[model samples]
Target: MKSIFFILIFTFSLNIFSQDQVLDITLKTLDGETTNLKEVTEKNSLVVVSLWATWCVPCKNELDAINDVYDDWKEETNVELIAVSVDDSRTVNRVKPLVNGKAWDYTILLDTNNDLKRALNTAIVPYTLILKDGEIVFRHTGYTPGSEDAIYEELKKHL
Candidate 1:
């Protein structure tokens, strides 16, 4: 049990230490504007792209968890959180009201077709990738009480 736990910790740390995979993927915003992924990450100290959905329980939970400490993350480190909603056409319309009601302090973007999701190779909601200098340094899927703290540490590495 101890060995497995240590291995898990080691592997997760390795994921954090890995170099960023340069990917050029464009996505459309909810308002119908196009955005290039590279354009957002390039020349930035830290850019976090999160793939989430309005109908996903864990997705909402992770966003809510992050929202709880987003301000603190900003104050401590100028980490920019770009939340890309993967909600399909059916649930897409609900995003705005949901975000407004939650008062999340992160930027909300839409990916209705899941192009960005496939381009990023993640099939799950709450998929988070952290980039520094336009290079992916850390990535995590799902959330727990102390996971945000771990992500904050990753952002600090590039700051």
Candidate 2:
């Protein structure tokens, strides 16, 4: 009986992790247009959702590294990257200028209220979620110098 209970618990835990999905949340684009997270994922076979902030160095580095190879990734895997800025009202204005100055070719969205962040249970900036068929397939938080390669490798798996 004890062994059976443990097996059941383990299976339930695995199921919970495997079934993670993005919640439907409305966010604003840099162009002041409202967009739904579910809708964005629906349009793409694979979508890379990056939660970042203007003040995070690691987040900036991660995005910059991804930017350098974004086109290649897109061509290879048909993946679309959606950068969501979690900067509140004070720093929200900086998002557009920073994205423009860096010449990042990503679909930028503003999450001033962090509704999406809370829904995703993301604790910090530089959180990345790989969505396949509108469902969460992989998730990674924080960043390291060569982490972009790991992300590319994961994308390759879905291709």
Candidate 3:
């Protein structure tokens, strides 16, 4: 069933170990600056790559949850959260205003072609991958309340 596939593969519990699969992902930031996943990891000890859409309620919720603690998280871990909006061309227009309106401090990027999503092997909104030392350390999707705690805990370990 579709639900089964999502639960099994889309859930955050799934762990991806292959470095080649997640690295070499180059995407344009919302500001039109080109960046690679590994580059961000190099800049920081840890990097959180979140694939989301402006229209996804759960995706919005996850950002909202992190906006509260992100500043402190930065202070402690020097971790950077790159929020990639997977909004297709149709809805991409609103990504900026929505993010600006929400006041989320995470770095925003645009993946209109979904290059990163395809590389990561999951297209579902709200997919999150944590990269440490240029390797994916953890991955999760479809967040529930308090999932941020689990991610923060993992980040703590990597830091």
Winning model by TM-score: 2
Error of 3 at 20 (Å): 5.7
Q: Per-residue CA lDDT of candidate 2, range 1-159, in tens?
A: 999999889867654654378778999999899999888889998999999999999999999999999999999999999999999999999999999999999999999999988777556789998998888888888999999999999988887
How close is every model to the real structure, measured as TM-score?
Answer: 0.80, 0.87, 0.84
Q: Output the lDDT of residue 132, model 3.
A: 82
Among residues 3 or more apart in sequence or in different chains, the pairs in candidate 3 whose N, CA or C atoms overlap within 3 Å are: 12-140
Any runs in candidate 3 off by more than 4 Å, and if so which?
Answer: 1-22
Candidate 1 per-residue C-alpha lDDT over 1-159 given as tens digits, one digit per residue, 9 for 90 to 100: 999999889877765554467467676655678887677667567888888888888878888888888988888888889888988889889998898899888777888888777666566678898977777777799877777778888888878
CA displacement after TM-score superposition, residue 4 of candidate 2 (Å): 29
Residues 1-159 of candidate 3: C-alpha lDDT, one tens digit per residue: 999988877555433533343567677777778887666658876888898998999999998998899998899988899898889899988998898899898888888889877777676879988888777779888889998999999999997
Relative to the unseen true structure, what is the C-alpha lDDT of residue 147 in candidate 1, on a scale of 0 to 100? 74
- Model 1: worst 10 consecutive residues (lDDT sum): 14-23
The lDDT values for all models are: 0.79, 0.90, 0.83
What's the ranking of the predictions by lDDT, best on top?
Answer: 2, 3, 1
